[model samples]
Target: MYGAVLADGMGLGKTFQTIASLYSLLTKGINGQPTCRKPLILCPTSLVQNWGKELKLWLGERVVPVVVDDTRADHVKKSFQEFRAFGHGGKPKVLVMSYPCFRMHKAEVYRMGLDVVMCDEAHFLKNGEAQITQAVAGLASAKRRLLMSGTPIQNDLSEFHAVFDLACPGLLGDLKAFNKTYEGPIQRGRDADATEKQVTLGLERMEQLMKLCNKFMLRRTSTVLKALLPAKVEQVMVLEALLKGIKASEPTDKVVLVSNYTEALDVLGGMCASHGWPALRLDGSCSVKQRQALVDTFNSPEHPSFVLLLSSKAGGVGLNIIGANRLVLFDPDWNPANDLQAMARVWREGQRKRVWIYRLLIAGSIEEKVLQRQLAKQGLSKALVDDVGQQVRTFSRDELRSLFRVDPTTPCDTHQAIKCSCSGSLQDLDSCKERAAAAAAAAAEGAGSGAEQQGVLGWAHLARALDSPDPTWQAVSDFVRNNFVTYIFSDHVIGETQHCL
Candidate 1:
């Protein structure tokens, strides 16, 4: 019963590592029996071919895997039969399938005695009640299960419970027991107003949970790849004016502008058109063939396109737009995991240039709230996964009271809550979550450039702007100085540090 969750940082090669594991384990038998491990891989529709490719690339002729994604039912059944009756001559039998494909044909293949189940992009099962989760759960006979996700846990512990439940059934007890035990107390302890006792209890429970999970889990960050990766600088700014500033670094440089909404991408596309930047786009409207063609065109390196407009939801997961070294997350998402997944589309294994990430946010608005929630969620994730405990502040309703309340005169609500004003001076720019409320009376009016000024202090592009730097950096600086950027500041440069859980 080897169950594990390989929750490594993206570009750290979780797939390669898992393939190595599969190569080793599939060659052996369980309990001294002649039968080898029968493994089934379930992933997003986009990653089905990727899983097959990785298997071939890694295992080569040593393991021939049958990929069953044909839309035709008879064809799919034939592939399933071949995969099921696959003699253990080629190590153990392997079948690669998309989540939907597996669900559609589970009844025909569930009785095939699948011993090992690997789910890539496992976050798709974050909703415990989703039909996907139930479908994956149908493999009750799988003794060894693996859930692989670079960005696994998202907003709440409930979602964490959902994914972990699929990987290791009773590891956290049933959902109710898990909530009452670890989720309830740890969450109460993380609140801004939690008492000392509650905080201590939360720390203890978090430590206990990680200690238990570590026995069956492994996580590593991009720090391990520090020598291989070039330096990365991430900055944050605001809307349309921000879009107008982006320019390709060189003839080879490419930019990808991502937004969570297709309508938003339409607006951004219009903005790019007005600026005279050559651009291509991919969203829900595009067919699968069209989407891949666009991705290939964008990643052509010598392609004349200056920008690629991406709908975050449509193009986020399992994509490698490595031709672009710079990315702008035009807006925020309720789940930081989605944003993280989109951000990884650029700065990947093939990227040679120093990567730049820019996340846009509106001051004192729902988008700002999303950024705040991202920080809090990352904090909770760190506490759960790392050896050290962090200051936890999961999202709550009290903070949502200031949905649009703007007090331009205060410090970052994030800084004040974390009690670390040192991130940047709060005077120049302020209006994060901590100071989010004031909607009733003596407020509703204003919001910083100390944070505005200092956060970007040593950034090469803007710092050396006088000598003719990136036009985008200079424009962004001017925008911030004039108070055009209402909110700014994120965790830090991603790859240079440990970003996980």
Candidate 2:
């Protein structure tokens, strides 16, 4: 059994890549080994239909996959009945199913074994104690397992351990051993008040973890898609900054609103109705069959829909809504990957218009704290996947305490912390102009390495908006369309990450 990971950033085509991998194996047998004809694809319920669509679109008459949407025991058992008794012959078949559906029929799957067992958005198995994770841990020890996730580690290193351990069981040892060895030392180094020695040790262990994991993981940033797509501008604005319909100003502009909670979606839907904006929606209440219809209607120019109301959990993955060049993530997700997935819905390869993605946060609220946490997680991901700078965030005892207390002192705690001096009186605003020029020069000269390089990857674009949401906001919004945004991915700064597909 072998385990590997395809940790490409969102919209970089992990789905199509997986499909290609499957196509290659079925069409060309690996030298001495027999080709894999029976493979299982486990994904979220919402993606069950899309997976089959992708496979069929690519493979066409060469192969047909059985997608198990009906999860009743008899139906699931019947899907695998051939596996129980027949030999591998005739048409090469594939099985695509949701995670919950696989849980119910794991016994049948386990007994039948498999050639390839791949999990999409494998981070769903991040929780070690979750029943789904536990079930997947067993029964695939002999098969080749491939885990695909844009975010392998979300909150902490333990989540990485769980998913990695599943894909390549025992590669990182058991949870307790992994925590003591890698998790503890790495986290301790990120503390704000940590001694120099602690920082050095954290860097060492992080590199070691990276070295071992890189053997099987193939990770790529969204930069790969830069050649195929048009420009994308992503901004992180306090809700107060949404003074006007800035990004989606045109009556013909297509927009999408994604919320972490469905109730919030309801409020947005009602707001659309109040404005008499035509909209289509996909959520838990919507059936699987209706998902494509909703997407088609939203994507079609003739439909005349103004926006698509999407609940992140349901429509986030395996969805392409390029018809809408503008998207607003109404709220932040504790796990940055969720927000990243939702944001990638539009700024992908097929988009014709320049893209704009907005991440709205209430200043000084716990919501802003969530954005800060996202930066830290991005650091961990960057460290593990690429030889990139360390971005994992560590909070001081006082900083952690502030989570409960709202700071009325600052309009933007993030800008204040970095000591950017971008916001204040009109005089400070002028200084911000000078500092912005210097920062742009520094970035052109390659900026500082590691952590320092992150703050400057793309700064000239954000200078004005840090002060006010006047035309200043418009400047930054327009600037983002052509630049790679690191301000949002910085461990110290606050903003949206690169969300290109």
Candidate 3:
């Protein structure tokens, strides 16, 4: 028998619905006998503890929670080895694990013959080739399976196929046939007539597939779940003066106010080396273990308060940093969805108090234009591919002129109160003024002709300097490159000889 999937939006209680469903299953006496087969709840590691907490609150003493933290190969193997032994004997009713650990112990998970497999935030398996997706696909033999996600299609239709494939394999047929019939024509940006034909056929097929797998999947939205909760307060905190630190400066208090990810990674790497942890590159290329360790350290209270560098591509979703109450977005990303998800990590339920989110925008740069487009797009209730195309056509010329007019010398007098915007109290006005002045100075420096002379360098340059062939060049190169971006901000271009080298 297949179960339903409750894919409610963020801040809507999908967690609560999951717990209720599990409780209903647990209460039913199977064949007049108490069933001991526990459900397997697979989720991101950051949410493992959250799920455990929720389960304890709902079912209290009726369920057992086992969290798998496999730091090494042996640790992972040993955990699964025990799961197989205990699971076969009709042990606990629920086992929770992170997606990473689930993949490592997939063979054991299948061998244990779980009754129900429930995946939360299931969008992690959107990429068909990812290890976790393959592992999930292999678990189709379970008695019941449930897949859950809020925004199932963040980008395109192909992502939906991966989730559906896991829930009901043959229903969608195969990827090739599915794509040729539906996605192939639609993704081409076909004419209105062709697009309508494709959508009509696609929805018909989708309806049939839903009917076939009606017992397996269910999707719910926020509007349907609103009645279940009480009135809530939403607080918005805006820090408009923060500068995106693409340019570097000396270690001043203002510099610390908004450190770019590159600088944060450098500092974190040094700290890791000093603490005997393997030095980590906080780029997208880092291994899973490296990232987990960095996250553990950052969340630890004993560790010095420091910035964590995260690439939006890798760290935008699934990762949670519990200790961070304040967020300074160094630069805006291309996708509004990615940025919103990244910010949601700090604003989620477990947060103890009001969280402050700061978005740094370079007043007259391409960054500002990007924000403008995001705001404009958010206002539209319907899709506007044609309008977007027309805007893109005129974007370059209009954006260039706007970018040149970002004057930092002009006073930014806008002010809204923290908790109550209508309070009219001006206690924080002085602090806001100082920040505005600093932002203006930074923007003015960025707008100057000198900024163009300060050529940008890649991560490779720093990597080479750190491991230079010549010992003499090591110190010199490191010092020069370390101060390169900062020096450029000062209207002096140093290490021009190393430009080609």
Ranking by TM-score: 2, 1, 3
Q: lDDT tens string, model 3, 177-266?
A: 878865664443322233556655544544444455445555433323224422111111122212112112111111112223566556
Q: After superposition, how far is residue 175 of candidate 3 from its true place, in Å?
A: 1.9
Q: Estimated TM-score per prediction? A: 0.81, 0.84, 0.54
Q: Lowest-lDDT window of 10 residues in candidate 2?
A: 484-493
Model 3 quality (TM-score): 0.54
- The candidate, 1 or 3, that scores higher on lDDT is 1
The global C-alpha lDDT for each of the candidates, from Candidate 1 onward, is: 0.68, 0.70, 0.48
Q: Cα RMSD for candidate 2?
A: 5.6
lDDT of 1 by residue, 288-381 (tens): 5466668878999678898899988778887778888878988888788888898888877877876767876554456666676676776666
Tens digit of per-residue lDDT, candidate 2, span 1-501: 388888988788888888888777766757744467678899988888888888888887676677887777787777676444454446677888899998887876777667778899899999989988987776653367788988787778899988888888888988899988888988888778877898888888888887888888898766667677765555665322232344334556688888978899888888778777777888999977688768977999888887788999889876889999878889989887888889888977678876767777666778777776666666566666654344434445567566656875545565554445343344543443454455445435543123222432223224334433223245345444223222231111222232211
